[model samples]
Target chain A: MLDYPALAALAEIIRRGSFEAAAAALNVTPSAVSQRIKGLEERMGQVLIHRGPPARGTATGLRLMQHLDQVRLLEDTLDAALRPASGPATLRLAVNADSLATWFPPAMAALPVLYDLVLDDQDHARDGLRQGQVSAAISSDPEPVPGCDVLPLGAMRYLALATPDFLARHFPGGVTEPALRAAPAVIFNHKDGLQSRWVQKATGKRLHLPGHLIPASEPFARAVELGLGWGMIPEAMAAPRLRPLLPDLPLDVPLYWHVQRAMVPALTPLTAAIRKRAAADLRP
Target chain B: MLDYPALAALAEIIRRGSFEAAAAALNVTPSAVSQRIKGLEERMGQVLIHRGPPARGTATGLRLMQHLDQVRLLEDTLDAALRPASGPATLRLAVNADSLATWFPPAMAALPVLYDLVLDDQDHARDGLRQGQVSAAISSDPEPVPGCDVLPLGAMRYLALATPDFLARHFPGGVTEPALRAAPAVIFNHKDGLQSRWVQKATGKRLHLPGHLIPASEPFARAVELGLGWGMIPEAMAAPRLRPLLPDLPLDVPLYWHVQRAMVPALTPLTAAIRKRAAADLRP
Candidate 1:
């Protein structure tokens, strides 16, 4: 059997990113934390952490931490079932930035847990589940990872939008492929495919886009409003101040809720909450 | 010289995170893009990219990209001086979220460049410069990276804030060490030291803080406002709806603008704009 205390220490080090920070979080001396890891490493016959100034977990370390998280979650749920007044659980979830900015918060608010949110582009959020980095995820991919359940959470509609001034200046000839290729775009990040997908959907051709890259959801929307670029914005966050580049062609990305099957019992309330919020905010 | 077109291809591949995506951005066929990289790699005699489904840069690859960026910026500035109608340059920068959410956007707007922003904790932002991932960075550390000039940009004051209900429920006996240990906090992320620093300043003791981790500046503050947990909030974002736990013991983190000395001539307008906005928003 593994030393759970040492396992806990390993998880803390990865989460906090340093031996000293993890020591502070665990209320232990750095020396003690170091010793525990050393002993555990010796017992396991493998190195688990890369001891950088900002420490990082090796693959084995991450796997162990994932295991600990699952076990603790199960225990917490069991304790709650018995006592009815146990402390709130800690759930690490991967959610897209737009969802967090728009309709997701109410769902989060309904859960009685401390959240550790990992924000990724919706198209790639499922990678968090595949990599065992998150307990659950909100993703555009409907396909479930092995040992995970997928629940359709409806679709987030995106409109290709720009400010009035931006449209007047850049698309004086109307929203043509040439104008789109020439105009700047506000891209969320490298992983974000909404802009390219929207362009393809609207124009039926793939075009090279020059743009500003702003990663945050709010700022990406704000950049379009500031006349930096045109972008595909979630309909929920599409303010009246912005006008659509192609009003007839809105992209609706279907999102799914993926959770480890074992976690379903503990996470039913959150699932219900997510469904409730998505129903109101997402298009059919 | 050293195959500038091939280097541009490499940068695009890294930025877009896939060979196909890079090809789309460069308006080249994927096979042509592949040949350019192949020839470049043979010329350099070292691997430049980790060809994942989502591609990544090697250490040398990133260094080359940084070199290309600086060259492009200098050339763009020269072109503007001569003809004044050249295309906008792309400037990659690292900035702390709080500053971006509050005082930084105006500075960005004042500059005539397409921005690629990297968000990190204020304490860690300078690493982007040290690692050559960015030409400039907004950091809390006054010390400049080697070959960089640091300009003090005043300070962001923080207040230990919580909802009235949270205070009543969690700290019935006021903000003592025991109560602090028992109550949860809202932390920005692993690199965020504001809460620990504030707690140390207030109590002169290190306490293990149980908390929720919300990475975004707006969502982090919103977590505290939603009563998920108390957190150290930037004074600019501390809403009237929340009350300070210890009003007198505010933490002021001084910020600095770190720019590569060689790029300083091109960034003069941005520096002026940053100073102007910081003067209005940050505490002296």
Candidate 2:
């Protein structure tokens, strides 16, 4: 059998992408990470990592590492929940930009429980849970982790919006993928592909546009409202000022709540709280 | 604004927790869920659900409903490499037993991905993504979701195991909270927690008894193998197992998976092929 701790260290190195980075993340020396991976490989009787400047995982090593990742996550959640109270249970959570910008703040403010909030784009939030960084998470995935519980939060509606001026300048007449692609588009980040997906759905073609890449949540929304570019905005946020240039074209994405299975017992209160809150906040 | 779809109807009802599960889930059912909740309230809501579920937002409805679970996940993984496909690409995924055993499969597998695959018991399989989940997935979360794109795959892990021989001999050896509050223990779920949390770490109360729940992968490894007085397992399937051990102890519990958020684009032909194979063979 592999030395559990050493394997864990190796996995971390692979996860962090390099020995130095993994060491930095773990607050250990890179040499330690290197030794751990080397030891793990020798114990397993197989090479687990593909060494290079920026190291990668060998096939078998990657497989073992991935499995170790799951086991560790489950173990951590279970430990946190089952272990006696050391302090208030800190629920590390993730949320999307639009939700945080428009609705999450109120929900967070309303949360009666004490929690350590780690906010991020909804897409990135689940990563925290997988890495054993958080106990529970608000994710777009309704799917539960292996030993976890899942609650459906609901769908967040997205509307394609733009300031009257931006629309006039971009669309001129009617809105279509070609037109939108040609016009400058606003994105929370280059990774905000909702617009591209939307365009593809509308025109049956992929979008490869070069435009402004604003990297903040509130600012991204503001840029669009300020007539910087035409983009997809959450309906809840769009409800106030932004007009739906294309009403027929809308994007609706479902959301979910996932909690570690081991934490289920401890989660009763939290789940209840979240469910109650979701009941009041989400749109129909 | 988000696109509201009809498929979300049933899902929304369930999510909103009643006929009014949540309008956000239904997209067209706020009043519908309301009427449903109201009607159900007249019929069952009053009995099944409590009023003031949480807080209704500013004419926006459920404040919690505004939380987009999926978006949060996607955002976390947004930095990942784009899917190889042009249009709405299918996302192959990997997960574990606890997640599959719970309610998550439905929500995630139910989605209309271009293609999707879920690797079960991902505590050991996440490296498959080094092999790929098309784009991402739910795995035993540890370190980053791997490769830049990372997020929390919130779920829990539990330790529980038993064996026919052991049970026959022990017969409720401290089963309840007050009972075997001290006894032999087992930590079955593979690097999981049955012994550590419930016995030792939990308020420092030791099992003092004997035995260990050696973690196992599948059919042979469930709680029954170790003779631990019905250990903690994911709630989804634990109930059935408890049937045989009735009057002894209930073993159902929950676990979690912290997922990574790395997107290895399906750029290379080999990578693309593996992704395709994974989607076909791995999804639950």
Candidate 3:
């Protein structure tokens, strides 16, 4: 087993990429960081840090740092659970930008307990947890984080949303499969798989759209609302701003809830409160 | 959030169905478990478990217990990462029965290292990681356990594999989408999505198979190899045991690597060694 404090310090050092920077971040002396790492290596009977100008990690050191990252994530989750809910419990959560701009606020409002909320893109939020930043996350993946619990929150319904004008201008013939294959589309990010999934569904073939790729959640939604192109939008979020191009056709994407595992102790009350709120807020 | 130790204890209690039994499993006193729960509740300002003739989790408690279950899974993953290797720092990963019995071994061998080998199914062998079992795992999911790191290991190529006899018996005039839709198929497990993926590939339709749902990995492979039924097998795994029924047919599934994130520290040495051996062993 590695020393907890030393492991933590090493994580900071590796993340910061320099002893001096790590010392500055932790408000400790550079010498202290060096000494601690040396001590840790001596204890482990293996050299952790590779001594060089840039200062990269040895194979063993990187593994330990990864472990430390998980420990920190578990710690943050535990802190969230342990924090007294005298006021509102803080929910530092990650959600897709589309979900946040659309249905997330209502879900947050529907929570019986007051909560201090922080939201980010689903792709980046888990990184916050790994860095000891957040407590819970809503991800597109069904797999849970290592020390975290995962639950199927529910699927978010998406529709190929478009404005009446855009539909008239670009897809006048009722948006058939062939037209869809040739039409422009809105995507949240470069890695967005929705368009492909749609194409696969519509044409029975996987085709990549060479259309515009906008990364911002709200801007992307607004662009679609302004008739930039036909794009997939969460049904709940799209309900108020846009209408489904085809009222009968909707796409459903699964959403998962991942919470820290070690945080289970403190999570008991929080999960109870969150689950109650989620059951009411999330779509079945 | 919930109490870490307490929530873990609660999960054990629920799994064991008795405080005494849980205590024995944890090697602690029943009174200690009781005390831990009491402390946990006081910290959370909520009643979690309902103590009575048979101990049961309150609705809140059940939610908390579920969280703990996920946490335990992470811990198991962590344990797998930290396990000591006997000779080399290389890992012995177990894969799913279908993957191992099919295409994954070549991929594993194709890696750049010679790993101490053990192959199992996605369902069974993943437990090895949770129980301090293995160092790395190739799972069907992209999500990493809480304490683990995740990477896109790449996708597996699947082909409809069967003995010539099986194909002859089922589709005498050579297989087509319609014949496949009507024939009795072999499934590795009830939850196995290979058959469905294949169905969708062949017909652009998602249809559930009405054939045998065999759960065992080796037997499942043997069943297909022995002309039992037509099922999807990894392209590499199928190379020797069985020939592709349709060489030009398209059927593939993504494969992912879910490694203990903490194990990233050890990755430098581990990966280096694995890569060396994988160059000689794993198939492209």
Candidate 4:
């Protein structure tokens, strides 16, 4: 209904990183790309692009982009209904790398959609959805976006464990703040705080050991198993391997699912499937 | 010079996945996107795209994309030389996720370049370099790309370890193929063959355990330490944590660095920095 053409042109400029690159992708001259964005800005009564060498979308532009993404989703749904056999629906969802590596795929496999998966840290999962990069997302955020739906998906439990040799070598006496400080450990990424949070709770110390960081979930677990250092891990995963560094630590992480409020009937089935699957696999 | 615009258009189509998305990203009409590809194919006398709901680049297309990428890098170099006062060069490099979290950042920090890091499995790091997605790459491949120079960065050793409790519980008798199959192991991803390779060589058998996948290196180590299952880990990381499953099996993985042949004056300092740093950090 709105000027979708102009709106798309603005979004493209930001997505492509520069006007020149955007023009090349658009099959248009740089001037054309600029003109389209300018016209849209004039109409909206707000500046859209930052116009830097590496261009960025202004706050208003980002909001517009989010609106455009939502519109596209709704349009896709409408098109599917109008023409059932047009093509399979393409579903874009943002999720954590750990979930992607482990329990997430089965949940997705249960759905019949052309999935475009965007993997990120759990903390940033909702960001893609907010930024119009994904239609649905799973996050630790129980708070729903104003017009989005949210569902509780239970907790993912992590236990602190270490190899006998590692514990003996690193913490000969006991798990002390000094041992925690001195010992080389493994961290998922700069963003991951499960280990840090646990350390603070147990030892009342903020720990930042010279640790090996592996961003993906599977490798992080593998690194721990190879006795890199003591770290918090999912209880289910650590079941066979559990040599607890602490007396008790099932660092329970609560997870939640967030989806667009207005979606196709297809999304209903997807939401149901995910709820069922998460409830089954995750610690409720 | 060699229809760089058209070549970019073709690559954008494949990268963005759909003609509509490509058009939006490019700020061009869908018709223009098609025309650009069509014109490119006619000029080159080759089919560059495999037209589908989700489009993919053909061998020729992928090759052209790589070529275009190289040209852009060269142009960036030229620009930097012409304007030394310009901001730091944005150097895009592909590396193993483990290195990204470990030794790689320090290596980058030593340089003046603004790094755009691409993290992948160690084995797949070279693909991005070959595809021209990255200016340089660190890989396990000692073989140089046709025009790229290869530098040996030495080997990374991974020790197989598990918690004392885990080893005692799972392998009460002794560690063997059957016990391994039953024990919960941690792995990075399906692409990661480190665990599988070690298992095969050790037991002369294939394994597909009820393993937990923690894709990130740090988390994989953490998972392992939590007694999720045994895994291969960096020797440096595992030194304090070492409860070796196989006393003699330290999975020694050789590493290499590959850089574009054309880059020298700019790359010399980077190469020196990486060499000095890697030599200092890596296991011989």
Q: Tell me, by lDDT, which candidate is best.
A: 1
lDDT of 3 by residue, A1-284 (tens): 66876876675565445777567545678898889998999889988776654466676776676565445434454466674322222234555555444444434433222222333455456664565445567677776666578878677777888777778876788757657655567765434668668767766775544343444454355557756567887765564656666667777777776776655554566556546655665667
Give the alpha carbon lDDT tens digit for every residue of A1-284 in model 1.
Answer: 78988988998898788999888777789999999999999998999899986788887887677777767766765644464343455788888788887888767777667787888765456666766767889888888798799999999999999999999999999988888888889987877778988888878887768788888887778778778889999987888999999768999999899997877887888999999999999987
lDDT of 2 by residue, B182-204 (tens): 33443332244344455444435
Better of 1 and 2 by lDDT: 1
Provide the TM-score, chain A, model 3: 0.66
Please rank every candidate by lDDT, starting with the best.
1, 4, 3, 2
Once fitted onto the true fold, the runs of candidate 2 whose alpha carbons sit more than 4 angstroms away are A1-87, A106-114, A121-124, B1-284
Q: What would you estimate as the lDDT of candidate 3?
A: 0.58
The residue-by-residue lDDT of candidate 4 on B1-284, one tens digit each, is 57766776775676545676567546688899889999989988989889974587786786676566545545556654574342233455778876655565555535444344557765456666666556688877787876678889888878878989889998988888778866766666545668777887788875544355455666567666756568888876674654998788778888888987765445777788788878987887
Q: A38-83 in candidate 4: lDDT tens per residue?
A: 8888988989889875588886786676566556545565644574
Shift of residue B260 alpha carbon in model 2, Å: 35
Worst 10 residues of 3 chain B by lDDT: B83-92
Candidate 2: tens digits of C-alpha lDDT, residues A219-270: 4565576565667877756637677767787887777777766556655655
- Candidate 1, residue B151: the lDDT equals 92
Chain B only: TM-score of model 2: 0.38
Report fnat, model 4.
Answer: 0.01
Tell me each candidate's RMSD, in Å, in order.
2.4, 23.8, 26.3, 18.8
Query: Where's the lowest-lDDT run of ten residues in candidate 4 chain B?
Result: B83-92
Question: lDDT of all the models against the reference?
Answer: 0.84, 0.48, 0.58, 0.68
Assess each model's interface with DockQ, reporting 2 decimals per model. Answer: 0.61, 0.01, 0.01, 0.03
- The digit string of per-residue lDDT tens for model 1 on B97-138 reads 888777787677777678988887654566667777788999
